[model samples]
Target: MDMTLLSRLSDFEWRIEAHGKMRVPAILYASEELIRDMDNKVYEQIVNVATLPGIQKAAYAMPDAHWGYGFPIGGVAAFDPQEGGVVSAGGVGFDISCGVRTLLTALKVADVTTVQQPLADALYRHIPAGVGSTGRLNLDDQQLDEMLLNGAQWALKLGYGREADLDRTEERGCMAGARPEAVSEFAKKRQHREMGTLGSGNHYLEVQHVVQIYDEASARAFGLAPDDIVVSIHCGSRGLGHQIGTDFLREMVLQAPQYGIELPDRELACAPIESPLGETYLGAMRAAINCALANRQIITHLVRQAFAEVIPEADLSVLYDVSHNTCKVEEHMVDGHLKRVFIHRKGATRAFGPGHPAIPEALRAIGQPVLIGGTMGTASYILVGTDESERRSFSSSCHGAGRQMSRHQATKRWRGRQLIDELAGRGIIIRSPSSRGVAEEAPGAYKDVTSVVEAAEKAGLSRRVARLEPLICIKG
Candidate 1:
């Protein structure tokens, strides 16, 4: 990485030649400081991704790129099966479809403060959070399988939330290709009790107030009003996704060579798209996605119920739900040909710009809503996909203000109680089942989100529409 190997494409873009074992070059979008701050291993990971079978164009990294297991965390790669593509479990990460979802409430911030303490208490009492937290609703094996297959739709049928909520969600609240039977028993056991729960480490349920409006017209289109209190949940498929990633990495490593696949890096071990092992992993991964979607749906209902007990006027409606990790078959124009390819997004959100068929009819004109959750003590933003994004990237954007420090470093620098008091003095209420968890996600531990958003806008990945500040945060 230190060699004068990278060619500057623009002030915001850089290209690294794919010399050895690489089928294509690696493209990275970032500023000078952001790129220099990136770990050198990210360059190697991106090169490894470039060597992927049937890979199209080049492996690309978002402005928030960082070193990760296989592909850089903020990475995007596409494989054309027609050209003999392969799927890597590492590309999907442990938290399949781990993403952010925000809801717009009818009430304003002024209304929330009337019973803020009670509202927080009720949410804390009802919504399961923290490590190993379990929901009150227990499911038998058969019921769990049903939920895995049907996703949030299953939760809605069981009285968790309203049907209208699905409209704004990606894939209409359910990943279409889920196969519950393909999921392992161990994975099922771990996730059975975790449904509707927010697991620890950068996960939370927060009530925010829209503090700034960037695109006045788009904000109105998305039903976001300035100073409007909203709920944002950040979590994922939990143990089930972790278990699937673990199970497949072993299988893929063992069978990769058998499928005539060579590993540029062991962590990038993958299976041919046509192989049975690849199909099995996809099925189970999709099932885990369902668990995540259903999990958020159930939590939304719990949060709504909690509000009813206090404010009663808080009408929370779904804005959008999108995941940052996953590998899905998508149709993209590669080299002037319309082709079906498997696109892998790790720690990156899909920004389906305006007029794309995948977006819901209601939001098609305004494009997809991209929710970028900030550090616990910072501000989150809502952005819209621009048509230019699909052309510049593979419709990919940064997921958050990428971590600037490790959790251990963050916890070591900031103490829980003191951090809580500091935030409260700024009019931000912080509540958690664990304060240590609070310190681990200190806002200063991450890069400036405003800068990250600016980078995304400049890269044509996504354009900012509104900024949301946390009023009340419940950490897990």
Candidate 2:
């Protein structure tokens, strides 16, 4: 793919003009080099997204954009129901609400250095991870329904975590309007024993140190300080979310024609929002999102337990927890009027600007923190949404150091033990059940997140707040 074919709209933005059946233009935000490295499939898929029914303004791709099932991994689009808005399972993704949450701890980097190995071992023991891993919870049909219906609140009631923890989470830890009846028996069965497990493939738990603080005031507001140790948990709805996405995608494909919706790609199959098919998918998707929230909430408790065991005096408080996938109904100003729109954000984080009522009160002054998890052995960043981000990209920002190589490609060239030793030489600690996992997540397999963040900031998506490097990581 000749990336130079992408005409620039600005220093950090490019556009693919509406062509053929496209109803809107495609917008991509990334550095010149990043664009060159992107797969031609990404560009082709973004073009397909532009054809989605009732899509508003434009279809936006984050700096992390990469080819995925249908829409690119880092894709966003808003649709208006009054104009035949449609919902696509591809947009919501395989793992609904797969996201990141980081907690600030009183312990410093020096404190962890003393017993890093012990702490890593303790965290690994406490947090269940690996392929097909399950946790302590075993739910029957009735209890699974309750968990799906109530989400994180149900987990809290089960003594997973406290209510105050909800305050620091997006949507207060439970997605409203969730209807478990929309979920299938297969979905419930998949989630029965997977509640607290961090299932494999890119999901992880890392203990890191704040290496730099860019916005002092914002950092203070977020309860972060230089060199302070932090724990980051990243996972999603597990098998349940996947089952929901798959079931709905099949239904949407068969029903799109009934709603008079055309698909440029079968993977982008969708049904009109008013259609029974759309409502069914949305309801079930929201329930899966709630499942993810509960899953993360339970993991939060495990993390708390690990910290209490290793550093009893440390106070671990959540800075923020935000999902990077899922679709939601939101009101945003379009054409000078408030409009209800369905916003699809897959592998992208919501970075609502300052003064937005959606942001937590304490964080409204500094804007929402955009948590960008980096490669397993690399650095992660904390950024604050900008007014430009809200205005230009539907309050969306980059999700991570997007994959630069396919998992197969990564594994073929790199081995697990070598990666472990290499990271340890750089003072990064690691523990994982699968050596193949390490090979698949080699740092060399991802784009330079630092470059991506720079483009995002320059493009006014999100401004940097702080950067963190891993001291310990548990991969699932």
Candidate 3:
């Protein structure tokens, strides 16, 4: 954040020149004020990422960047396998494939307001949430393997979600090359009951209404309009993903020396892309990605069930689903050469441009939908990917309003009960099993989302489409 440490490339871009063991420069996208407010650790982590083997172009931090395990929470980097590219567990974080999905509804703001509390209550009761929460559907070993192998496709075949929903999902609801055999039995055991549950910490199901439209064409393509009611679910692969990350991080750390990988930091532990450990890690990681997709698919069914009970006429349909915290194999142009590489996005969202074949055909004309969730009391934005972003940060954008303070710091500043009462006063209803969880995610605990989104747009990471304000929030 210190101006003295960076060379300004533009108002939104800053560069840290390559030095020491760094393989490339470090690039950051943020407004001056946001950069100043960002934790100094973000710079440290990003620079560390630049030092990793096989990293392409430069390591990048988004406007909402913050301190994280190894790669900054909003970091983006691509690695070339042919160049000995390594995949770091820290780069993908613990919550594998954690992401946001927004659902469109025929109901308007007025309709949701008529039964707001009851709807919130219904969602809370039906959708399992909070720490260690388990859902009605439990998977056995065979089913677990099937779920990991097929992802949301498995859910669809079981009639959990519509066939149309998969079209808008990243990787079409399944990351390819998932190997259930690669995942540990312990990881599978941890996930046996966690499916369809929204785990604790920064996960929630919110009912929102579009408050503003920035691009009419993009909005229309995304099936969004002012005053239109929508539901956004934020979560990931629960215990399964956490266990995989834990297992891999430790293995990478202990085995790094054997692979001739020197540690600038132990937390940045990684394995060469073509190595046995790396291949095994990728297989397991892809399974976790499927786990996350399957979990969201099942949760979507529960949400629709809730809606049917409360307002059957409300046509809730899939908008788009995208994940953060992933290392995906993608082809991108580097030095004017089209090459396939692994792109690591930690707390960053994929923002593929218009006409990208990877995106759903229905919305490809506009671009991939980038869902940005805000705190319980603030506004969330919906944006579309831009062509410029593909050339900039490997088509990556900020995931959310990054934390301005730690959970402990936030709890010190506000009480859960008081915060709930205050939000209720503003016509926002919140339901959570743990009041302390609400305190941890207090609005003031995060950077201003509007400012972060503005910086992203200005930096050509993505283009704003619509803004959404919460009507109800079911937190974990």
Which candidate leads the pack in TM-score? 3
lDDT of 1 by residue, 169-206 (tens): 88889898899988999998888788889888888889
TM-score quality measure for candidate 2: 0.98
Worst 10 residues of 1 by lDDT: 1-10
Between candidates 1 and 3, the one scoring higher on TM-score is 3
Off by over 4 Å in 2: none
lDDT of 3 by residue, 11-120 (tens): 99999999989999999999888988887888888999999999999999999999999889999999999999999998999999999999998889889888999999
Clashing pairs in 2: 200-476
Compare candidates 1 and 2 on TM-score and give the better one.
2
TM-score per model over all chains: 0.98, 0.98, 0.99
lDDT per residue, candidate 2, 37-102, as tens digits?
A: 889988998888999889998899899899987899999999998999988998989899999989
C-alpha displacement of 181 in model 3, angstroms?
0.8
Model 1 score (lDDT) = 0.88
Note the Cα lDDT for every prediction shown. Answer: 0.88, 0.90, 0.94
Error of 3 at 82 (Å): 0.7
Off by over 4 Å in 1: 1-3
